[model samples]
Target: MSKTLVLMRHGKSSWKDNLPDDERLLKKRAYKDIEHVASAFKHCLDKDFVFKSSYAERAESTAKHFLKQLGIPETHLHIESDLYTFDESSLKAFLYTVDDSLDNLMLFGHNPAFTNLANALGDQYFDNLPTSGLVMMHFKNSSWKDLASGKTILHLFPKNLR
Candidate 1:
């Protein structure tokens, strides 16, 4: 069975200047971008699709906007505190733990790491995955444990929808 992976960077987040990084929220522009991107890919999502986000408010709210726009049930979403770390090693650790039962996994998190993860898992290389950027790929392996470089099926940037 082919596994599908959707790696999306959280929408542009606000800087309260004094607020903690984990409490930062999404900007108005990010909401618009999330709507556009989520709507563009809604049809491909299945009931088994799982939306996972970082514990950070920005990432969590980004996933929330995506679910609201896509009309996907909240039951499919998960908030993992470890995702906030933003490292390839942590990303890999998380991926390895995913059950093979769910083939479609959507990850909402920060850039650099998200950008790095996609490049590591797909043939396409992205220098930067912009705010609200989305990268969808398919793995030939049957299990997430076997996931490696796969086909880069789609790339969506928020600017494309603007």
Candidate 2:
């Protein structure tokens, strides 16, 4: 079966004097952009999506808001600390952990890993993946374990919407 991987970069975050990097929430533009992206992506969403995100507050907030706007169920949402990586290797490794029963996977993470992942596993190249950015890659492989570079079905970022 074909599989889809939607890689999302967390929205712009608010920097606080006392808050740790991992604890920072979404800023105003992040919220608006995330909402816009979610709304635009809603038409393509399927029930098969297995959503996952980095454990950071910004990533979680982005995923939650996207889910809420899309009316997606929280059943398959996986908030993983292991997903918080600076490179695509960890993200690829994490994808290997997914069950084969699911065909569509949505991943929320950070950059430059996200940008790297898109170029590495997609048919296109992007210099940067801006806040609330999303890349939907289509793999012909039947199993996530066998995932390889696939075609870029969709490439979106906050700046694109503006």
Candidate 3:
């Protein structure tokens, strides 16, 4: 069986100095972008897909909006602390640990690491994965352990959605 992975960076977040990094929330514009992106995946969501999100507030907020748009229960989403920062290796390891029963999965996380992981798996490089950017990849095999560098099926960013 083949598996599909969709990676997305959290939406734009407020940069208020008073707020701690982990407590920062998404801006209004970010909410709009999240809605748009989630709309694009309505079909898949209807079919039931697995979702994983970083524990940080911004990422979790983005995931919440996506779940609402998809009409998926919050119970289906996993909040992972390791995805909160630049930890591509840890992200990769987590990917490898996903249940084989899940064929379609989405990961909501931060930048640089998400972008790097996308590049590493797809065999290409992206200048940057903008806020609310999303990349969808399909693997020939079902096992995440078999994933390697440069095996992507598609890449989509918010800038391109306009």
Query: How do all models score by TM-score?
Result: 0.95, 0.94, 0.89
C-alpha positional error of residue 79 in candidate 2 after TM-score superposition, expressed in Å? 0.9
Clashes of each: 0, 0, 3
Local accuracy of candidate 2 as per-residue lDDT tens digits, 78-129: 9899888878898888889888998998999899888998999899999998
* Tens-place lDDT digits, model 1, residues 1-162: 889999889999888667899998788899999999988887676536788999898888889889988777777788998788778878988999999988889898987788899989899999999999999999988899999879999998988888
Tell me the RMSD of model 2 versus the true structure.
1.3
Q: What is the lDDT of residue 98 in candidate 2?
A: 89
Clashing residue pairs found in predicted model 1: none
> Which parts of model 2 have CA positions greater than 4 angstroms off?
none
Output the worst ten-in-a-row residue range by lDDT, candidate 2.
39-48
Cα-based lDDT for every prediction: 0.88, 0.88, 0.82
Model 3 spans with C-alpha error above 4 angstroms: 149-151
lDDT of 3 at 77: 87
lDDT of 3 by residue, 53-149 (tens): 9998999999988888877788888998877877789888888888888888889998788988888887657888788888877778868888874
